[model samples]
Target: MSAQLPKIFITGATGLVGSALVTELLAKGHHLRALVRTSSAQLPGSVEQVVGELGQPVDLSDSQVVIHAAARVHVMQETTSDPLVEFRAVNVDATLALARQAIAAGVRRFVYISSIKVNGEGTEQGKPFKTNDVPAPADPYGISKMEAEQGLMALAKESDMEVVIIRPVLVYGPGVKANFRSMMNWLNKGIPLPLGRIDNKRSLVALDNLVDLIVTCAQHPAAANQTFLVSDGEDLSTTELLTRMSKALDRPARLLPVPAGLLELSGKLLGKDAVMQRLCGSLQVDISHTRDTLGWVPPVSVDSALRKTADHFLSTL
Candidate 1:
C-alpha cells in the first residue's frame, strides 16, 4: 500500500455501485468523503458526509480522486414528460459540476461510472461493443450519460485532471432490485418460465468486479484519459443463466419452450418490451482494451458471481 492513500470523494455512496465502491476503497486504505442529500442515511463508521444535492457545487478540498457514480437510472415510461431535463440535472449537469470542483481542488484523477448504453442498445450479429465505437445512446438516460462523458473529456483537456470513464453492463449482486430480483423470485418459486428457447447473449458485471475495476482505474497510470467497457467477460444466454441460477439454488430448472416472438409481443402489450429486450437481447461488451492496457481482469468468474448472487437470495428466504 502507498504510504499516503489518496483522498477520495464519492457521489452516490448509498447507491449500488457507490456503496460497493466505498467498501472497496476502504479496504484499500483510501481516505473518503461522500456527498449525500439531506434525506440520505449515514453510511458505516467514520465516512465524512458533506450534505448537498447533486445539482449543487461540491467541495473537493483534500480529495485526490472523485468517483461520480450518482445518476437517475430508471427507464421512464413513454409518456414521461421532460425525461431528458430530469436526467440532465443529475447525470450531466451535476457530474460536470463535481468534476469542475475536483479539478479546482487539484484532484489528479476523476473516474466516471458510465453505462454500456453509451455504446448502443444491442450488438451487431452477437458481436460485442468495443470502446472506440461511436456512442449511440438510445434513451434519455443513455444520452445524458453520453453527454456527461463528452463534457468530462472536454473538462479534462482544459484542466490538469486525468479522466477515466468506465462503462459497465448489467451489474448485479446482493441487494439488487428490479429484473435481478424478479429473476430470483421466479427461480425461488420453481416456476416454469418460457425462456428456454431464446438464445441471446447478455453481458453482466458482478458488483465486486465492477468495483475492482473502478479502484484500479482510480490509481493506474494507463487508465488516464481512456474509456473502457467492462463485464464478467463471459456472456450467457437467458436459458444458461436460469440453469445456473437453478443449480446455485439447488433447485430443478423448470423451463418451457415458448416462442420468443410471442413473449416479446406480450411484453409489448404490457408496456414491458424493455424488460423482454434485456432478457432476450444480445448486449455483449469487449473488455480486451481494459485487460490489455491496465492488466485488469475481473477478480470473480461468472459462475462464482452467479453462485454468490444465488446464495444471497437463498439466505434472504
Candidate 2:
C-alpha cells in the first residue's frame, strides 16, 4: 500500500462486518466514505458518512475502491410469498445499481462480502467447500447473493473495475447477536446441551480474522477477479466448540450424551429441524486458495478469539 492511502467507500458501515471493516481500514490510514441510511447513527471519526438508501443513486466519484457490504439481511424470510421481488430490491437491483455508479466514478476495485449459503446448505461427507464448486443456493437469500455475484462479474468484464467476492461462514465475535448470544445464554445458565454426543465439523470465522482477510483483499493484486471461501482454517464440532466456550468462560460445560437422531426427531416435532440441523450439521470451507494466492492467514487463533468473546460476555453480566 502507498503512503497516501486510497479513498475507500463502504456501505453498511454500521453492520456487524461493516463496523469492524471500518475500524480496520482506518487503522491502515485509508480515507473512508461510508454510505448510511438516514436513520443510521454517526460512525467513527475516521469515516465520512453519506446519507443514502440502496435504491438511491450513489456518488462514488472520489472513491478509489468500493466495498458493498450493505443488505436487507434477515429482514424477510426466504420462504416469503414474493421473496424474489423483495430480495431483488436491495440484494440484486440496488447492488447492481451501486456497482454501475462505482464504475462510472472510476473506482478501480469493488469487494463484495457474500455468504457461504451461496454454495448450498450442507457440505459433502468429510469434504469442505471450495471456490471452484458450482453454486447451488438453496434459499432466496443465497439465490439473491448468487445473482449479485453474477451481475458484478458481468459488470467487471464490461468496465475497468476489478471485482472480488468473498463467501464467509458463521462469523462470531464481540457485539454478536442471535446464535452467538444463545450459546452464551446456554453456557451462562449451565444447561446440559444435547450436543455432547455429536461430532459434526463446522467452519467459523472470527470477526478479527475476517476483517483482516477483507482488508487484505481490498489491496492485494491477487484478489482481483477472484472468489474465495473464508474461515478460521479450523473446523470444530458443536461439542468441541461448547467445550472451548466453557473453558473460556471458566465454567463446566454441562453436556448430555444424547443421540443425534433423537435430537433431530425432537427438533422436527417441535418445528425447529432446520435450526437443529444448522447447529449439528457439518459445514466446512477450504481456504487453501486464499493462503496460496493472497499470502493471507488468520491473525487470531480460535482459542484466543473464543476467550475474548467469552470475556466480553462476562463483562456484560
Clash pairs for candidate 1: none
Give per-residue CA lDDT, model 2, range 1-317, as digits (tens). 64577789999889889988988888888999998876455577657878888858878888999998988675523567887677778899999999999988899999999899889898855898899899999877888999999999999999899999999999899877888878988987898787888878999999999999989889899999999889998899888999999999899999898988888898999999888888778899999999999999999999999998888888887
Listed in order, each prediction's TM-score against the native is 0.95, 0.96
TM-score of 1: 0.95
lDDT of each: 0.88, 0.88
Off by over 4 Å in 1: 39-42, 76-80, 268-271
Per-residue lDDT of 1-317 in model 1, one digit per residue for the tens? 65588888988899888888888888778888898886456476757888888867778888888888889885735556888998898899988888887888899999999999899899854689999998999988899999999999999999899999999999998778888888888988999999988888889999989999999999899999999999998898888999998888788889998878888899999999888897777899899999999999999998888888888888888
Q: What TM-score would you give candidate 2 relative to the actual structure? A: 0.96
Error of 1 at 241 (Å): 0.7
